[model samples]
Target: LRELKTKIACTIGPSSGDRGTISELINAGCRIFRINFSHGNLELWKEWTDNLRQVSSSLGVDCVLIADLRGRSIRFASPIDAKTYSAGQTFYIVRHDGREGEVPSVDSPEFFEAVSENDVLVSDDGRGLMRVLKRETDKIMVQALSKLTVRRGKSLVIRNKEIPIPNYLSHCVDQILDAVRLGTDYLGLSFVTSPRDILAVREFLDKNGSDIGLIAKIETISAVANVEEIAKVSDAVLVARGDLGMHFPLEEVPRLQERIVGTVTAIGKPVIVATQLLGSMISESVPSRSEIVDVMNCVVDGVDVLMLTGETAIGSYPVETVNWLRRIIETYEGDVRTRREISQDQLVDRFALGVVELAEALNAKIGIYTKRGNTARRISRFKPRTQVFAASNDPKTICRLMMLWGVEPIHVDSKEYDRGLEELEQKLKEQNLVKRGDTLILTYGLLDKPIHTIRIVQLIS
Candidate 1:
């Protein structure tokens, strides 16, 4: 796809676990595959990981696999579960004794003693909430202010809301290490709410001798409040809008996403916008128009990764969604023609620097002609304001250049027009690398290509 733009990450699950589907996802423009620890057992995860390895090897693609830890998930203990309720819904979730019928004793010493006053018990993935009101030897009263209806095996969140912790996340530190041990390139820690939590995870990874990258999921008030600190400590951060919106007010989610993204961008680390972008596509083959707008907003706000959660995990149209997203990102980014300068510093190569200076003197927009990706990196290091478009002969080179900042890449046939300057500009314009009335900076010329000049800059209109 010559018009491909934006970095895409798709979650790999039962629907996309096979080699064929995984490869399809890759072809559709998924650079990362995420394995969620919460859904399946370790054996299942191993099988999925094997499939990912096989696909990446055959395709020679930069596929980053992220292992998601299944952390602490507290749930209810029965059928007809009651979840978030009004101010006072006296509900009882009795522990099963294998009895056939009848509501078990709420007065049972065993069940009642497990609860205490002031315990913030949230059920059904934080949809149901309650606070302990009164405590006795065998029964405790609670005030239910959240809607909650739960069943056996469903999650219940009983946490100290006033505690100085981020959230009652899954206790999966060891599980995280398991994925790290599997040669997964990235570690996604769920429910990360503070800088300390991220630090603790990284320290654990380092202690285990794992070099995998860490991504902190921001989904709580504490995490959003302390986002500045978390961004500094995290290798990357995920603006997990799903639980985040549930945890806080809905009106505040958008602003929080923007705030976190902008802060992380300042630190020069990747920030991912995850969950529910194409949520409807889990069953449908395409995403909603609003979803497309959501993704475009992410790109405009400078998010490094646009993520797919359930859409690629259990979704029937996982591969289709990936392809759709790839097309949308490419289409939207192509319309953004304003030049964004990234830097003004000089590079290690004096010749490249001289060329850049000449391009500026010519008032041209600098385009680093590179096939190997080195020239792009060197130019980005200088952080010039000129929008950097790295034209390459290799598609992989273009994809890999994404790791650097502000370096957009375009792939072309190097041999077709290496001999003439006019052909190069024509090709550039045809590829939408530069538009009419736009200034251009050209970096081309290799001894092997029969040119000794260190390339020069020229204005294009």
Candidate 2:
């Protein structure tokens, strides 16, 4: 399989959870796996994580596992039988005991108090919306704006209120702790509203002595307002276009995505463009023209990762979705040849860019030796024409580098300069990443050392 600068992250679920199917996904160029903590139990997640690790090890590939935390889902308690509603129907949402025809009490008491008449409540994954016509002490009378099949646990989004969700919801705290114990490479916090939310997760991880990367999902207006502050503290930020669209106008989502990507890129952190990149592929064998255009636009916008949610989780053509996404990214990125330069004021970032420019100008590959993958990320922002071989002994660093653009991470053993370089060169040659007589611009730095070195190397038989 050919590698692209923008990585493909597939959601692991019942559709693609088996060993054989996962192997096919990896062979089809899926670089990362997202284990949603919102759906399954801890036992199921651990099983999936262990299986993913074994599969990646056996296949000799890098598949970074991300545990997506379910933070503050605004659903309501339901009776034994859930009722479905149609357009123009009047439904009632009660905070107390609701009858069979009436809507059940919502999870958050704040939701009932914050919403008023004339406000809109979106449900059915944002496809179904309702307008509140009247509000009483215990119930809200709403007019269905669209037909929807309401289920027991479906979350309702109130567009008027800026809902304050907890950093770690009740159900996700145990999952987060489990993720740290299982050595998950990253944790995706859904519905993040501020920098303090990111810090909350960070504090918990720190208290537990875990170093998992925190990815803040930008799905709310508050998150967009505080995106820069959140990006400043987050390891990465995801443009979760699903709920984000519900919060803002659908036409405005693309611009919001671009804005968030640019902001996070400027901060020198990875930006993931997620949710419905290939939504049509969930049922169809191929994606629609607009979906293809959307993927291409995101790549052009300089997103580090393109993610598939339902397209891979419960889709009929999960493997094909990933393959098609990879093909689209490869074709578009090759044709566009765009460069996303870091706008940081640090000398190290400038040095990294200079090295990348040198490599591009000289038509030489960049050989980077980094322990934490920061140097490689800095270089990747430039989008060099030549390949980037990021060599790291740290497994976590190598795994996390899977999300980086234009980087092919290789794991090395020795920290010694000559030994590590020789091993890395051998691996690259064996893998045909570099050929004999190929020139390389090498960058390396010791973990304790404050200095970074950039040099030249030529391979000869």
TM-score of each: 0.67, 0.93
lDDT of 1 by residue, 128-232 (tens): 677778766644566677655555445444453422333333367668767866877777877666676777777777787865667878876677788888877
For model 1, what is the C-alpha lDDT against the true structure? 0.65
Candidate 2 per-residue lDDT, tens place, 53-125, comes to 8999998787889998877767766633667778999877777444443445675677877888999988755
Candidate 1 regions with alpha-carbon error over 4 angstroms: 72-170, 334-461
Off by over 4 Å in 2: 76-84, 96-105, 165-171, 336-345, 417-419, 446-449
Whole-model Cα lDDT of every candidate shown, in order:
0.65, 0.82
Which candidate leads in lDDT? Answer: 2
Among all windows of 10 consecutive residues in model 1, the one with the lowest summed lDDT is 100-109
Worst 10 residues of 2 by lDDT: 96-105
